[model samples]
Target: MNADGMRGGGRTLAAVDPAPEPPRVGPGAVLRQWFHGEHGVAPIVVGLVLVWVVLAAIAPDFLSAENLVNLTLQSVPVGVIALGVVLVLLVGQIDLSVGSVSGLAAAIVAVGTVTAGWPFALGVLVALACGMAVGLVYGVLSTRLGLPSFVITLAGLLFFAGVQLRVLGPLGSINLPFESWFVRAVQQGFLDPRVAWVLVAVWVLAYLGTQIWARERRRRAELSCVPWSQVVLRTGALALVLSATVGYLSTARGVGYSVVLFVVLVIIADVALRRTRWGRSVRAVGSDRRAALLSGVAVHRTVVSCFVACTTLAALGGILAAGRLGAANQGTGGADTYLTAIAAAVIGGTSLFGGRGSAWSALLGVLVIQSVANGLTLLDLDQATRFMVTGAVLLGAIIVDMLVRRRRQEA
Candidate 1:
């Protein structure tokens, strides 16, 4: 061949050869990205730590084993309810009536077991069924009737509150029997130290296993994966934190049954939201309902499911709260309860704009709110101040969320 022809042949050979892949990122880079990324949970985690330190400094007894255990106990009701709120928010909907629904469920349980001569188990089931029915109604109203969720749930809030009042009737309040098995389990039950430690270990192992499986799956799909070292480091850190928490709690009363229940629900929710096709649809709807509909998602069904989940969890929370207090009263589910649950979900880093949140947000957010309340109580602050502080903190959290969302959009 001529020189030009030979050069052309060489260029053709070079074009046919595959290019080299880029160098994989190391653990340090991965860590940096995690800390700086829009999706990072680091801010809330760090904020929690800082709040603890401040509270500990202000009230030396704030970190006491007894107080910490009490704080955990106090967080249960709101945390459980907030989990439902998180789900609703993830689907870009709101259920303002959850507190009233909770109140109604508690009333049902109290009236059935205490006044109507029904079995305890039956009462509990009835409460849950009522919750489901309320959810179904709300779902149908919002989805089929084309009513706004806010309006529907707002009406529900008023109607359910009236129902709760009617259910209580002349008595207005009823104390639960302290000897009841359910009451004792919710308020006083705790895991043995050994069992707590074992649970922590199992959780750590499960987390690591899932991470490894995810990495392998991504590799198979030719998608980028986290560095193995990053995965190991992340797992190790999580294990250490979890182990330490369990060890501390074990030294006190061990983990509360309520806490365990809350954690289990959060874990289940997280898995469903992250792994299931239904979860993807929820996210899609939250992100853009029109787009999700165009993509063949069952937007109406998803909305209904979310409402159902929210109300069901709210009912469970009410039951737990009744157990904790050993009573179901006129004040069982009040406006304060409603606001606190919503605030906790938002403060825990769930975006009010929806499409971005996790079940863990409920847990984390409730802890922060409860810690603040506990610390203020320890300081002998009045209820008014507590409300003000909580409101301020909630406002701050919303501001942060909006700023982060704007940044993400800009990016």
Candidate 2:
């Protein structure tokens, strides 16, 4: 062959040869990537740990079994409401009426069971229905009538507050029987130590099983998967942390049934949001409503569902609170219930801008809020100081969120 032809053939061979594959990412890099991901929950987790440590140092009793048990109980009502708030935020909507809705639900339960001579179970169901009905109205007003959610829910807040007052009458309070099943369940029920340990084991096993299944599925689909080593390490770490938590709590009154309920609800919500079509649709709508509509998502339906979920959860929270306090009164859902619930959702790393959050945010956020309140009380601080501190923490969370969002956009 001629020299020119030989040279050309060599160039073609070099061009056709596959470039060397990029270096495989190490487990450490994978961990870092996961931590810095757009939807990462690492910041909130780290912050929670930091807060706990600081509070423990300041008030040794803060870490006492009794105080921790009280803390978990205190977090229940706001935590439940915050879960629903996470859903609403996911859909880029707000419900300012959650506190009022809770108050109304409590009032309904009180009136139906005490005044109207109805069964407790029946009264509870009616209260839930009332919540759902109010949510439906709010959903219609906001979606069908093209009204802003802020305005609609603000009106709802006032309306429900009035209803709550009227239902309670001039005396404005009704004490629940302390020995009632519902009250006992909320305020006194706790898991046996054996059961708590078994549940923790099951949770760890389930987590590992899911991870393994996901890895296999990804491999079969020819998609990238986390290294098996990384998976094992993560599972081990999770098991250790969960086991420690359960053990510590068991030394006290054991884990509260309310805490278990909150955890289960958060898990269910997390799964639904991460795995279900409806969850994806809600996220898409929140991210860009016009785009979601163009993609054939039922935007109106998603909005309605979110509102309904929010109000329903709110009602459940109120019931739980009533059971804990052994009463439903005009003050049932007053004070900063509204602010605290919303702040907990946001501070737990749920983005106010929407389209990014987790149900776990509610759990973590409420813990932070409750920890602050508990710590301040132990130090003999007044309500005004508590409010200021909580407000500052909330502001810091928002600032962090904004910075993280900006970084994500830049990336």
Give the Cα lDDT of each candidate. Answer: 0.84, 0.84
TM-score of each: 0.92, 0.93
**RMSD values, in order shown:** 8.1, 8.3
Question: In model 1, which residue pairs have backbone atoms overlapping below 3 Å?
Answer: none
Best model number under TM-score: 2
> Which portions of model 1 show Cα errors greater than 4 Å?
1-24, 36-39, 407-411
Off by over 4 Å in 2: 1-24
Worst 10 residues of 2 by lDDT: 1-10
Candidate 2, residue 386: the lDDT equals 95
The digit string of per-residue lDDT tens for model 1 on 1-411 reads 000000111112244557544343555545444534534566667778888999999999999988998999999988999999999999999999989999889999989998997988999999999999989999999899989899999999999999999998988998888888889999889998888888888988988887888778877876666667767777888888888788877778879998999999998998788779998998989889999999999999999999999999999899888889999988887768889999999898877776878788898899989999999999999999899999988887777667766765664
Candidate 2 lDDT by residue in tens digits, 1-411: 000100111112243557644433676555555555656677777777888898889888899988989999999998998999899998999999899999889889988888897988998999999889888888899899989998999998898999999999998999887887888998899999999989988988988888888778877876666677777777888888788788888888989998899899898888888779998998998889999999999999999999999999999889888988989999988878988999999998887767888788899899999999998898888999999999998998878777876776775
Model 2 C-alpha lDDT versus the unseen true structure: 0.84
